[model samples]
Structures are given as structure tokens and as C-alpha cells.
Target: MDVDIEDILAELNTDSTAVDQSGNPFSDINNNNNASTLYNESSSYPETNLKTNATSTSIPSPQQDYNNLIILWRNERCAPELLPYPHNLMTRMLSRIQEQMERLEIISMDFLGQQHSTTTTDTTGNNPVNNNNMLPLLCMEAELERIKFVIRSFIRCRLSKIDKFSLYLRQINEENESISPLQDFLSKDEMIYYESHSEILLKLFNDTILKHLPPNMQAINDNTGTVPMIDEPDWNKFVFIKVIGPQNKIFNTDPILIKGDNGKWYYEVIIPELQERVELIIDSIYVMRYKVIKDLLMEGKVTLI
Candidate 1:
């Protein structure tokens, strides 16, 4: 669990490449090429059919979808309560896409109207005909296409993350108070949306996989804690552990018995929530009473935060 700082830095620098410490590709929202690559990778899973309902004949162009996602992501931060529910997010985005398409139609009508008025003026000899009138209209059409493509790429970047890290967010939602600091990202309404979605997925996973388990293993483990269960690997990853009380002049260090090196593995971890770092001690370190950092990042699956 001791992560190599150099390895972490290297991954951060070359995030566009598909190979990380685990050989899986990392998410990069600025990359466009990753859309097709991620789609092809995720397509092998029948459970990952993420497209909107196909009953509606009007399909949104990728650009329009991307634009709506960006707008939604931004709005979620400012007005989390008003953010659309998970089931409705895509529907709302599709509506925005249709609006963009409608603008194209209006633009076409305006062009025709201008052309008709120009023809009348030319017939009266007020002005000579100019082919350049179409230039600005043509330019506007071209610009809209370019905008759509850019928006599509941006959306694909987020979609790729959702496709890959969904397992973490599967059980995360409003009612699950066990996960710490979720309030850092989600609002009350958004939490309800995700909680319901997580329940559905959790039930599906349990139903499909539980039947195959041995009779003794059929019952699920409901207890989740920071303390390791029997035979569970002890976490040695660097963490920000705060002292339970105020720091005084007298200090004593506990003997290092865990995995980290006595001297080399110690780090001054900053706790922004506490606004300070505490003195180091192997045993006195304050791990969360309920949730541990390892479970938050690794197992409990609250990835977005």
C-alpha cells in the first residue's frame, strides 16, 4: 500500500496514455481520441448499454450531447438541489441538443428571407446582385459543426470516466451516510438520484452473484469499518491522521511495528479540514472512526469525491 511518489507523479504527467500503475487507462477530460477507445472497451459488457431510449426517432448529434453534459456538470456545483435527477439528466441534455438543431433551422429560414428581399431590390435596380451574401451564412453553418464536434469530445471524456469508475459510485447515494465528505460534491436531490440508482445496481449484483455462492457465503456482509477484519490486509498507505486533542510541548513517539519503514516512510500529511498537520506516531494516528481513506478511495467506491 506504500505508493511510489515518483510513480504517482509519472501517472499524473502522462495521463493521456492508457497505461497506469495497474495498466488501466486513466481519465483525462481534455482528450477526444479516448471516446472511441473507451466505447470499444466498454461495449464488451452487455450490462453497460448506456445509450438513451431509442424509441424517439430523433437522435442527438454527439456535439449537442457533450455541450449539455458540460453545462450540467457546471450547474451541479452551483445548484446541486436543482440538478436534474440521474434518470432525467440525459433527457434534459437531449432537449438542449434539439434546441441547437432548431437554431440551425431558424438560421436557414433567415437566409432564405434575406435572399428573397435581395432579389426584389436587385430587380428594382437599387443594388447589383452579390454572390458574397451566402458567405456569412455558410460560415455560421461551418462554425456550428465545429462547435458540436468540440462539445462531443468534451462529453466523451466524462462518459469514459463514468464507464470505467462506475463500480465505485454504484453504491454511493443520499441515504448512505457511511461515506465521508460526500457533501463536498453532491446536493440533497442529486444524492437521492444516485442512491436509488445504486440500490438497483446493488440488488442486481447480489441477485445474480449470490445464487452461485456457497450456502455459507450467501448472506452479504453489512458491516463496513475502518478497522481491518480478520485476515484482511492492514493498510500502510500514507494518510493524514490528526491528533485527537491539542498539541502540547511534551511529545513521545510510539514504536513503529507496521509495514512502513521507521524513519524513511514518515510523511507530514496535511489535513485541510483541520487546517494543520499533527505530530507523527505509529499507533496514535487518528484513523476515521467510521470510514478509512483506503475504503474511501479503494473499496467503498466514492470515486468522484
Candidate 2:
């Protein structure tokens, strides 16, 4: 069957640059151990660096930024764990957003100039302002606002996580008081915020009530008792995800050879472990534990809803 090239290109809604040589975002993991592969391959992207102090000034295409920001926003919103900071993606997204804003400004200025100079009347001699000229500028402004909203929400989502689990995140990195602390799941700016926020809260607590406690009992992260003082994220939280990459054979595939009552061969196997034992087809939705799918989410094999 002959297919139109334009139709195929039109179907590629996301940025094609995201797909690597194998045409899979994570280079087409073909092993049963897919989760680990997701983690290892994520570092390949210039954007998803694990180093909290790392900086990225490279900008990707606008489409790539838009799609990636949406993915980051949605996953950050739903995931129980704080996903790795997408350094390059955020850098590029903000750059492109600023560029679009400048463009809108230029378009607005031009629209005003045209309105003052090119005033026109219809056959009825009515001299109303031309909304047709404002259409393109209005559309661009709307798009810019939408992108800005997504960026703000994405950052705010991360901030909320940082605020909620500030102690937990600090514990992840700052537990090592001897070494230079680096948040494994936070960006450099976010790390600053975390430190300031945590310090202020601790100081306020101590000034208000903790100062009266005994020195030994004043420890904030007192894990010595039945309940720990430090708050932690719910790693076992359930989330909805849509598969965006290939699945491992263990999922929705048979390993055993069997015979049916009709004497026909059937490959049947049971996996009582996986919460959602289904093949990862593109766009297939499933509900599963956040920790179980966290690696896949980082690898871009799936996105949270």
C-alpha cells in the first residue's frame, strides 16, 4: 500500500529528534531487565544529567521543548518520587519561551503601527479596527501564555515537592555532612531553595518549641523512636502511565510451551508479581506503583497522566 509522506510526517506529533538511532527514545531496550536500562540510558540525553550542579545552555527545537516540558510537568505532578531535574530541557524551554515572547512583542508593536497608519473603511464606510490583523498576534500571544503557564506549573510542581519533602530530599544528599552535598533529584537552584526553606523552618521550630526540649531530644530527624521526625515521600503511590516505548518480553508474552484440551499448542505463563503485566505498546495506559515505573518514566518509555 502506498502511503503519503506528508501523512507520515504529520503523524509525528512529538519531536523526531527525541527518537535516537534505533527510533526508540531509550534506544530500544530488548532485555528482560528494562528498568535498569532505563536508568543507564537516561544519562545519554544532554538534558537529563544526574549531576545536580551541572548546567546546560544548549537549546532544543521549540516542539521538543514543548513536548518535553509537558512530559516533565505531568510526570512531576503525578510521580511520588522527585524525578531527576531536566537541566537542558528546562534551559532550552525557557530560552525558546523568551524568544517567543520577544516575537509577540515585535508582532504587537507592528500591529499597533499598522492600526495607526493603515486604517481602512469598508464599502459601508465603517472604520472599525481590523480584527483580522490582530488574529495572528492574538494567537501567538495565546501560545506564549500557554507555554509560560506550563513552565510555571512545572517549576511550581517541583517546588511543591521540594517543600513537602524538603527534609527527605536533604537527607538524600545532605546526610553526608562530610562531603559537598548535591541533591540527586534536584537542580542547583532548587537545592538552594531547599536549604533556605529547611533552615528557616528548623530555626522557627527551635525558637518556638524545640528550644525547651532536652538537647538529645531536639534532633529533628529523630529516627530513634517509633516514628521518624523527617517526612518522606510515598514511593508506593499509584499512578497512571501511558507506554511510549517498546516493552520487554516478560510483559504480555509467554515463555512456557503447553497443550490445550483440543490438543493445540499454547504458550502460557503466569507472572503474579507485576502490578500491571501488560505489553508496553505505544499509548497503552496502565495503573501501577510509582516506584515500579519510575525508571521507565525517567527513560521516557512512559509518561504519567
Local distance difference test, per candidate? 0.36, 0.57
Candidate 1 global CA lDDT score: 0.36
What are the per-residue Cα lDDT tens digits for candidate 2 across 162-248?
A: 888877766767567555345434667888998899899999999998899988888887777999877888977889988655323
**Tens digits of per-residue lDDT for model 1, 1-305:** 23233533332222122321110001112122233322211112232222441212223223323433443443222221222222233433445446545655765676566667777867753333334544544554565465556446534444433333334444343347575334323435445554566568668867899778787655443335464222221234333332221111112321221224544222234455567663333224444312233322221111111
Q: Report RMSD (Å) for each prediction in the order shown.
A: 20.3, 10.4
Clashing pairs in 1: none
Candidate 1 total steric clashes: 0
Give the top-scoring candidate (TM-score): 2
For model 2, what is the error of residue 285's alpha carbon versus the real structure, in angstroms, after optimal superposition?
1.4
Question: Using lDDT as the measure, which candidate wins?
Answer: 2
Name the runs in model 2 displaced over 4 angstroms: 1-60, 119-129, 175-184, 246-282
